[model samples]
Target: MGIVVIKLGGSLIQGLSNTFFEHINLLQRNGKKVIIVHGGGPLINNLLLKFSIPVEMEDGLRKTSNEVLEVVEYALNGKTNKDLVIMCNQFNLSAIGLSGCDNLLLEASLYDKGKLGWVGEVENVNTSLLELLLTNDYLPVISPIGVDKIGQKYNINADLAAKSIAKALNAEVLCYVTNTNGVLNSEGKSIEKITKDQVQALIESKTITDGMIPKVQSALDALDEVQSVAIVGENFLNEDGSMNGTVFTKGVVFSE
Candidate 1:
């Protein structure tokens, strides 16, 4: 009766297929309270290009500046957030779009003081507002953006944002929705499942490097607090609209 928190990546939200919405509808039918945390890299990048703003990345982490933060908030909160809400409302689901900035729900610290600019890492999550939304059966669609105590707005990584919320809410499940089918090896084969120890091994070997490295690490971290953390394929939508992405847990594996 708790809840499920899904960290839907910006890459997926760039254009989620109808199949995804169907899966969400199914989850709602089953009386599951799902909160969606989203990112908007694609949209933000497009805007940056149009404005002739130079974009930069190191280790897949975007370099945030005041210029980039403006575009990020516009895309993530304005476009991406509302689009997901509209999609759910089409299925008669009550979806309320919001950003982490609302009510200071998410407090953050600059990811890198001298280099990362306004790219902030979550420091604390205020669950009171979210809990109120869920108690009323409203699916809270969230954009990962927050402001610091000094009123400096920061763009948060969606994966970490969702993890924080899930832990705060003591959610039963945390699913990370990405474009890929799931965790893949160097051979580009989907790894149905593996133990946390195995995941660490892959990380050590650099098999799971780059952006994916943080994702897997976050999943493992969530395991200690949440019931389960899954990295699933976006295509795994249920017939009734529930999510069907591949799930990862303690030693959970599926046959390819």
Candidate 2:
């Protein structure tokens, strides 16, 4: 069985359906070891609002100050992580919640020279810890909160975190679970498959904008190590267990 890394976007978590969990179950039954890396943007924003902290973001990444880091940790590690773990268990999939700081699951260094305060980019992934859990048939639900060698914690972008883990593990597939169906064209229809060059063209045309920019970039970055990558919605799996989404590839011919 090969490994699959699924990045669940923060915005999709609360709305995830029973079918989504069932799809994950099917993947396991089909002998695909699964690892989930999740985001908590909305929840973190809510917590920040509750504390009257100013919400800030640079590009698609959150600008995490020390105060913001505390709320991020609470929302991501404390709430979102456990919720996903419980959902997996309810669906009969054994899952364990984890923070990147736990056992240094994700070791990181500052991103952009600390321009974004506590924001970080992954420097290492604890593959041994992940493999141990996966070997025992336990799905790992990880939060994108990384720690440094000096015991300092930082907020990592979930998409990038998933990419790093997938690369480290040489995963067979990496799926980004987003709110939209997939990458949309000017007509707002899902494009079945896209290549790297085409992706840049779309970006230039402004068809792919904002947060999608980061997600697609992460997919391309993961392509160096992963065999397959897709940006999919909650109902990504079809009746035949095939994926239904915008598949990202290296130099394949495009097909809608």
Assess every candidate by TM-score: 0.89, 0.95
Q: Candidate 1 regions off by >4 Å?
A: 237-246, 251-256
lDDT of 2: 0.92
lDDT of 2 by residue, 146-182 (tens): 9998999999999999999999999999999998889
Off by over 4 Å in 2: 252-256
lDDT of each: 0.81, 0.92
Candidate 2 TM-score to native: 0.95
Residue clash pairs of candidate 1? 22-241, 23-241, 23-242, 24-241, 232-246
For candidate 1, the TM-score is 0.89
Worst 10 residues of 2 by lDDT: 246-255
Candidate maximizing TM-score: 2
Tens-place lDDT digits, model 1, residues 1-256: 6588988877887567877777667777778788989877778889999999988876557788889889898898898899889887887779999898888888888887838788888888888899899889999999989877887788887888888889988998888888787788779887877678888888888778766766787788888789877887776654664445445667746689
